[model samples]
Target: MDIATIDRRRLIGWGALLPLAALAGCAAGPGGYSLDEGVRRLLTLSTQRAFGRLLQPGGFYEDQLARISPPDAIGAGGPGRLNAIFGAFLRSEAVRRRVSLALNDVAGRAAQRAAPYVLESIRGMFTADAVRTLRGGPQAATDLLHQRIGGHVVEVMVPELAGLLRSDLLSALSAAAAEQTGIDYLELGRTVAEQAADGIFRVIGREEAAIRADPAATRDPVLIALLRR
Candidate 1:
């Protein structure tokens, strides 16, 4: 789809996710459930929820917590001096807004795809480490998740970022910004992608931490039954 089209439908197919926090608490009160089933469902639901928040309209850019900006210029004539010069030439407000929107859109799209892939990764990784991770530090599950999915995230996201850069609006902006600012626009595209991937990982890590901390998760009826007291 064209940049304009994608920008308009910013959240795409996934938005307004079920209030999972409330649901988890409710389900934890009474139910028979297995740890394996609980883990898989929790992993899938939590990841989808994370991505849903991330991809929502103004989700990334609107929130100070998730906002991302273009990487600072680096190299000869780098941030020391060239930064201001580059900024001056690439100063079209419209183009700037469009670029920001487009980058977020690409990131959101990649995140949508990532939700399922991450669930699969979690199933494989969490199964082996479930016991230790549950008893370990608050961030243990998150850390384990990062280790399992870090490489795959970059693999899945960067190329999509590059691919999105080929769109007309982004390509035009990149060329214009490059010519006007004398910065390597291509590298900037990759930087945006890398940052996007980083943002996705960062938020998912937070989700893992939240799940780890939730008392209800520990008290989850299904999970408790699986552990047999």
Candidate 2:
């Protein structure tokens, strides 16, 4: 058989097997979890993995996949833009790296704070409205996650981030910022927390999309089965 024919046969086989897997998982569970429960568990697992990856050393600051930098709050044609004006040292590679490290540190701290609450928050997201949207497409669950729990994550995250900001390489960032704005550490900490929270959510959403697109990634046999349905 040609490549296309072989691929087609494999697809057919998976389609046939997936529902059986789902049924087996759902039926054999301790209390017989609902399909929504299965989906929620899968999403929680995916989100945990996705955010956890970002907390590793170099995961955010050095990994090309997750690295982030300070926002360009400065706009075009500003004094700093054309004249290479004051505080230009803040843009130095060293300063940028320090800032990046600080941001990543804040994210890691925030993520740790958010961890215990993550599953519960996600479980709560499957409201009637959200369940209806889940059938919309791959992004529905993630969208609901953001809409429902994003703020809570940020709220939980910011204070932890703020606390850590002073200790986790905060001095380096503070020094960098001192040159520019005397470093409103709390305000800066909040911004960092918000950005980090946003980044983690984005990562989790991407992971959810991946699992939805490829049912096998759900890993739970029941979840795979439900996806087939």
Candidate 3:
């Protein structure tokens, strides 16, 4: 339909599916900067985080970002099947403070000095893959993730890891919310907006699929509001 209609849903889809979608096609890169060092470090970080999950029961809080969290939606086994895409994100990015604090503690110690660059490199890889997978561009979907990372550094890595880091920081997000508030629209709004403005990025994903099924059925006025801004 109109641009606004598309945007409202995109905001939510932006929140939810984008993160997981990015992850699924993440390593497949076709363009972007090169940080061989960063990729190596990320592999280390990823493995370390996976190890943490093995040692802990809760697995770093909620099941989304934790190692125990569901597999990337793209892989053979994941949360829900990849369906239609939708996204919702409140305008605010700073909805959660506690989660931000936890980023430093992701490894149970000071973040390694080399980790940021390493993570950045990994992010670049993911972004390139996203462009190929989602955009269906000249870059085929089956390229080196590193090449893509080198190609689309800022667009992919910045936003992608921002969410991942937020997830890491908010190790207690779901738990804390359940404990303090009884889960209301207001809280959930904050949760969704904060995480990705996508309702913890999950509902936004669901909405995207809905819109594709029946755009007329996508009846949230907020979508309109999101578009105008």
Q: Best candidate, TM-score-wise? A: 2
Question: How should the candidates be ordered by lDDT, best one leading?
Answer: 2, 1, 3
CA lDDT, candidate 3, residue 118: 27
Tens-digit lDDT string for candidate 3 (36-112): 32232223233233333322333233334421121112212222322211001111244333433343233212112
lDDT of each: 0.55, 0.59, 0.29
lDDT of 2 by residue, 77-140 (tens): 4545423532464568987677677777666656656655665566444445423544557766
Residue pairs in candidate 2 whose N, alpha carbon or C atoms collide under 3 angstroms: 22-225
Q: Candidate 1, residues 29-145: lDDT per residue as tens digits?
A: 225333344455445445655666776666667655456574546223566555665555347677667666766766666565565566557554334645555556655555666
When 1 and 2 are scored with TM-score, the better candidate is 2
For each candidate in turn, the TM-score is 0.64, 0.70, 0.18
lDDT head-to-head 1 vs 3, winner: 1
After superposition, candidate 2 runs with Cα above 4 Å error: 1-32, 62-66, 72-86, 129-131, 168-170, 173-180
TM-score of 1: 0.64
Q: How many pairs of residues collide in each model?
A: 1, 1, 33
lDDT of 2: 0.59
Give the runs in model 1 whose Cα sits over 4 Å from its true position.
1-39, 74-85, 89-99, 126-128, 166-175, 181-186, 215-220, 223-229
